[model samples]
Target: MLTLIGGGRDRTGGRGQTAAAAIHALLREEILSLRRKPGEPIAEKDIAAAHGVSRTPVREALLRLADEGLVDIIAKSGTHVSRIPLADLPEAITIRRVLEQLAVRGAVASATGSQIIELRAILVRTAEAAEAGDTEAFHRADEAFHEAVATAGRHPGVWALVRHVKLQVDRFRRLTLPLEGRMARVVAEHEAVLAAIEARDAEAAAAAMGAHVDGLSLGLDDLKRFNPGYFLEDSARSDLKRA
Candidate 1:
């Protein structure tokens, strides 16, 4: 079932946005965060009732989500949360890795003391989240750490571009967070990148960033085995069944 975060209340009321936009944002978050699992049905009428709005806004929100590759709308069957595109993961990870390498290199050149401090603070928060087994908090802090680095490097647009291409990767990552030692490993990787940034070594920072991003592909077969339905099956990955 599509469960709203706050008892289906209209949390966006009076936020100076249209109901469609608000609902779109809410649904997008749920989809990305894995609260709404892939292939899960999304009923328009239920969403409208949850938000106290008509079906028009719900439909509008769903259309936007479909455009973002987060929703699948069928003419006769129904709408569903789109499954993660396994084939797209490799290219998306490559793009994000390249952009983040650029970001960290730029940060090494332009990052100020305070910006570095802010990055460290975010790292600390990530570590704390990992220690507490708070996957969601760790995810947010992980994003913040990368965004801060990009901003410090004066390449905020790089982060924006990365976000656009990494949607599927993000959803895949959420699935990986609960794996044993995964969160702690991420914190360690972040430390390595931050250490290079603090040392003003552009090359090292870029290398660390690449490695960190590349690690997202690790354990893919295991994930597919555990949650087969969450990923879109690909001919190239037929071995997943054997694994």
Candidate 2:
């Protein structure tokens, strides 16, 4: 059974969706944050009880997660969170590196002095969030920092593509965030990228951004070492076990 964070289901939906959307968002966040571990069973009855909803909405919510590759739904079998697909890591990292490098280069070329200052201000807040050990806050700041760059670069649409590609990467990051000094290392990396941007050196910015994106791949080995069960070898996952 899953425990609802932030006071259960009543607190979640507001904009017209009272049941289905609320449950969907809650479950999606749990999956992305690794609160709901890979391959874990999602008990619809329990979720419905916790959220004070019927089984219908819970089922709908799980279906949405399934479409997002976060869960598997079988006709007669039970639903389970999808395990990390190791084979896809390289492709995801490559996509991020390519797009972010392009975005950072444009940012360096197009960002005004004030925009550069705004980016640094985001880093300062990121530091504070890291120090406070607020993972959600830190994650938000990190996203804001990158989105700021994309916006400054006048290619905000690029971020939508990055976001779609990075869903798996986000799960991996949640697993690694608790590692010793990981947040600090991220701050330093952001600073390096920002320094190049501040200098208005497109080549340096692209290089720095590439390095930062590439560093994410380095965490994969660590993730496999620490949470072997959460991921599946390419051949092992052809048919995932039902939870």
Candidate 3:
């Protein structure tokens, strides 16, 4: 059911890159965005046919995905989208929290009027998405809000690092967004962070950003209970509990 409709090489495929890289980018987005569900089967033959590529390129793409823990390539059983690594969430969230706090502090100090306006626009979009109860739209806006903060703070590299480290956290978050009142709460938190930024209060902005990032784990136990199949069963749960 994962269809790559157009020719394999498009915007996702950069110039001079191999077909495999393009396929990898496409599949990576699908996996990260939750369009490709956890543990769902990935048939190399189907993908090859869909993209008009050979099995070799498809295999290469999948192998790269496996390296990133986005998919599992079993010897004989076929590949599947990897389940969320529960153990990795706490560390990722902590890293994200630190990075985002720094970003917000920097933004408060250096954000231009235009940058502030852009952030405000993102906040408005987030609020509208929340009001409409559009989980997917809300999630996109939420990510954009944080990314915009980092950009306004002139720390786009920090945002890049956060993105690299927060893959599992993103998946976990997607699951949480549909929960009762979660979207509205996120909007409220973003408003608080943005308000601090608007006021040029670096400390307040940092604190607000920290609190917002920390909220990612607020209902971990409930999430685990309801979506057992989506998470890995390991010592990470105990680690998170102890933290």
Model 2: pairs clashing at backbone N, Cα or C within 3 Å: none
**What TM-score, over all chains together, does every model reach?**
0.91, 0.88, 0.91
**Local error of candidate 3 at 165, Å?**
0.5
Write candidate 3's Cα lDDT for 1-243 as tens digits. 344534545444367667788788889988988899888989989889987878888888888888788887776567888889877889899999999999999999989999999989998999999999998888888889999999988899999999998988888888888888888998999999999999999989999999999999977899889878888866233222100
lDDT of 2 by residue, 81-171 (tens): 8888888878898999899988998898899888989999999999998898888889999999999999999889999999989988889
Locate the minimum summed-lDDT window of 10 residues in model 2: 1-10
**Index of the highest-lDDT prediction:** 1
lDDT score of model 3?
A: 0.85
Q: How high is the CA lDDT of each candidate model?
A: 0.88, 0.83, 0.85
Reference-based lDDT, residue 79, model 3:
84
RMSD of each: 5.1, 3.2, 4.7
